[model samples]
Target chain A: MAHTSNYILGVYDDEDVLLKAIKNVREGGVKIHEVYSPFPVHGIDDVLGYKRSRLTIVAFLFGLLGTSLALTMQFGMMTIDWPMIIGGKDYAPVPSFIPVTFELTVLLASFGMVGTFMIISNLKPWGKAKLFDKRITDDKHIMAIDLGNNQLEESAIDKLLKDSGASEVNKKTL
Target chain B: MIAESAIREPLVTGGKTVHDVTEDISGRVEQKPTKTWMLAMAVSLATLAVGGYAVMRLVWDGIGMWGLNKTVGWAWDITNFVWWVGIGHAGTLISAILLLFRQRWRMSINRAAEAMTIFAVICAAMFPVLHMGRPWLGFYWALPLPNTFGSLWVNFNSPLLWDVFAISTYFSVSLVFWYIGLIPDFATIRDRATNKISAAVYGALSFGWDGAAKTWSRYETVALILAGLATPLVLSVHTIVSFDFATSVIPGWHTTIFPPYFVAGAIFSGFAMVLTLLIITRRVYKLEDYITLQHIELMNIVIIITGSIVGIAYITEFFIAWYSGVEAEQYAFINRATGPYAWAYWSMMTCNVISPQLFWRKKIRTNIAATFVISIIVNIGMWFERFVIIVTSLHRDFLPSSWAMFYPKWADVGVYIFTFGLFFTLFFAFAKFFPVINMAEVKSIVKATGEKKQA
Candidate 1:
């Protein structure tokens, strides 16, 4: 039984060096599992060739969903659930629904966006995540590679990281 | 990225490193409050004490404490509510909106704005709490507690209910947003803390953050999510406040434009308050390098746009009333322009609508003295806007017999003072505590801008 294990290959030094190393590794046809950073480096998505975020798509759909829900809830409540004539207006009043509808649309969309953001980001409320380099948040950049390939000799990977300007290289099996 | 960006040019042409940012901002906050902050605090406190006693007396004497009668049921209570609500807007802008836009300049001013938001909301909240007359029953309105009363559903549609929900939501969300951003910086202080008690206090708030890669990423995600949530909530909160008036039967009150008008006014005055604080803070904190003149320039542009929107709203109200040919609406406008509160109306116009135009000059927009004074003017103008709207409208209702001008009794004035004092007291304390700017975020932006920095 081959239980495939993923290893985190850390190339820790600075952004430019890490970027060059990652691109070199990718060009060498290495399949990376993930890259972690302390902060987002601009154009990194293109560098790693990651997919554009689907979060926006989800947000739009959720926003529409919210809008529909708000309009239905508001219109239905005023027009049907417990409609009372106020200020000589009719039982089903559109003008009066403006405030509630506006509020609800905002409420739902904002909530939906937040919920979607958290889910897509894969964040749990508690517990620290595994980190490649602690100092990446301060003054470092890091690239992580999964080291399951037979060709990916640990020495060669470490050599590649150093040659490409990695200040440090670490391999962790998790 | 840091090593790579080491080669990059700095954004502000020439700027300092992360260490410099820390030193500069800490230096800014470290100052003893200027004669100005002290003077303002003293004045606000005195006003509050005097006003607070008057209000207490009124509460004791019953509702007759104010000039409020059958016709003018709402007086300074509503005016103060509107003023405070308008004041709260700049905090949301500085934090949520600016964060979304990735504006680096936000760092210098956001602390003051967040403090302002918390304070202004406190001020706004006092009106409804006390105006309910049976002050103890205030909790009843927040009501339907499981123990005392059954879970009677709040009328989902009532603007008053919406105010309760919106105000509380704004307060809690702002607190979380402000606190979350402060945590890492708090950790920095914790590390630098000499006193054991100070270390413990900051350590608890900092949540053991060590600026690790995973921690920073998590912080960024959380901050973004919170900011995204807050942007619309900020808009909704004020819109709900506007609904308080728009839902009413009064001719001027019943309009579709109220939400946008109120929001614009809120943002306008909010920016003014921010300008006032940032000016003093930048000078006192010696944060001239961080909260640069450029930031003030950007704020001036916002103030002008919102100010213009308010001006348009004023014109649009006149146009709509004339176009609708509603006699009552026309009467409201006529009374506002020419009646007993005509001075208030004109003051609102000159201060809010007219003053923001001075920002067209780059020099004036960036000048701390000019911006500070304009902000104060805008704030005063906005207060009068609410006063004119509430007082003038209520003063002359549809019935001629019910027409009566409001003279804010000592109690009415006192409560307003107490509210401001409460706000300022909280603000002064907040300044004493937290790192007003998100140091981590600013460092990130500094890195992003690829500046050649020196600390």
Candidate 2:
């Protein structure tokens, strides 16, 4: 059976209040969905209990791949493919390959990291996003709690939000 | 958050709130282009048209259309290439290096400077590709591709080939870094758009950014790593460019100090160009509070430091030449100072070396008019620096019989004008459409350091 998804949206005028409210609401045993703000709030992720990101690992791996690919391409071409005596240097010339290797490593690491980030975050040109509150992109901080995911009743969640200093509480169904 | 030293001045003045930042920055994008903007665009387009014709003629006829002497195989084209590439360095230095240092002032200017980096790189690429004479054929040939030509690959031992890889990688990575920063700002504009078309366009540009804490956390991490990657990448790019000259056996070009010297000179020139444009941009867009006099003074200090480094490098070159006891190297330095191109050499000394020394005086550093004039002079001096390095070194070799003075043709001047046209056209378009200042960043800083601190 098809069902509607319900969310209780708590709008706050300032980030500090929203941050403190998040901790308070969590301690009140209500499961939170997400918090949206106009700008990145310092310590919001840690307060929300988000794990540290591993995108840097992805970048490091991609950087290694770039280094290998560059070396293989250069070595394969210079030595194995068609060895020549230009500039009176050796066939492979590893020292000379440093510049291209460095460039390629940076190129792939950044590209791979960003590409992975976009995919994981669902950031695409055509991707649709749920706009919880329009002011989330302006000055307001929005904390959206999925009613279906929480054990508490809708009224209880709304009361918790308001008591925790929400400027206004609204319900949204999608 | 680290408590910023109370002694320091605020990065963002005017007691702005988060809403005020969005309104002020996005307001320009939402409004129709001002008369002044249209006037600037018209001038840029007209210059582009003239430059475009020159390009078409050069392509239609040949590289012969350029004022290049066979004797000076690399003249204005190479000089312009090095000059433009050097100018691209400051953007990365501000965005990447300054970020690593946690210099908060960079937030205000990095977006525009990074945009300048991309545009400058594009202009820089034009000289070499066009210099190839048949760029349509020679462009791809420069790469190390598996080709139809029997078993022939690009020489890995060659610095010119390193340049091909370095420039391409630098351009691509800088574009990525700049765009990643823009996405959040673009989403801010997307959400604020009153019209559907503008909303859809900015939405696509923003790549559907959700302001969730998790996404933002990841975004910050990505930005830091990219900044880390780009710092060394920017350094490597200029080092490789210097390698193109230093690896050569020529007298002036064979110095060991070329890499550091070239890098310092690049930052000197790049900051000058940044100051020149930003001085004009801040006034035109009325962003005085964001790009304050403190920012200008800070950049002037960078000019003083890098400009002095460049000055020392110049003095070192002379010392090395005399100490090396190589007759050709000595002749090269002496010729540069007292020969036919002595005017250019002295101009480089006066503008790149002596002029920035004036910034040591606080009075001169903070004066906007003086900063603007000296910025222009610094760029002119940098252009001469490259010209002197390239032409004087090549003009007189051991062969006195083949030595000839280079005279630039109309095409040489026109093509240079073409790049200026292209750079400004791209820059003006960026200014009009994209958020010139990073609104999200400014908002974050405003929260921390704005005159009205949040409770």
What is the C-alpha lDDT profile of model 2 across B44-105, one tens digit per residue? 99999999999999999998998777678899999999999999999999999998998989
TM-score of 1: 0.79
- Shift in Å, residue B443, candidate 2: 0.5
lDDT of 1 by residue, A12-70 (tens): 54455666777887776666666655344545666677655554455556667766875
DockQ of 2: 0.81
DockQ by candidate, in order: 0.15, 0.81
Q: Which candidate is the best by DockQ?
A: 2
Model 1 clash number:
7
Model 1 regions lying over 4 Å from their true place = A1-18, A21-39, A43-162, A166-174, B1-14, B26-61, B98-104, B142-153, B191-195, B208-228, B448-455
Location of the lowest summed lDDT over 10 successive residues in candidate 1 chain B: B144-153
Q: Model 1, range B136-240, lDDT digits (tens) per residue?
A: 867766532322454343344577876876787677777767766676566556555667876677666655554433334444555676688789889888888
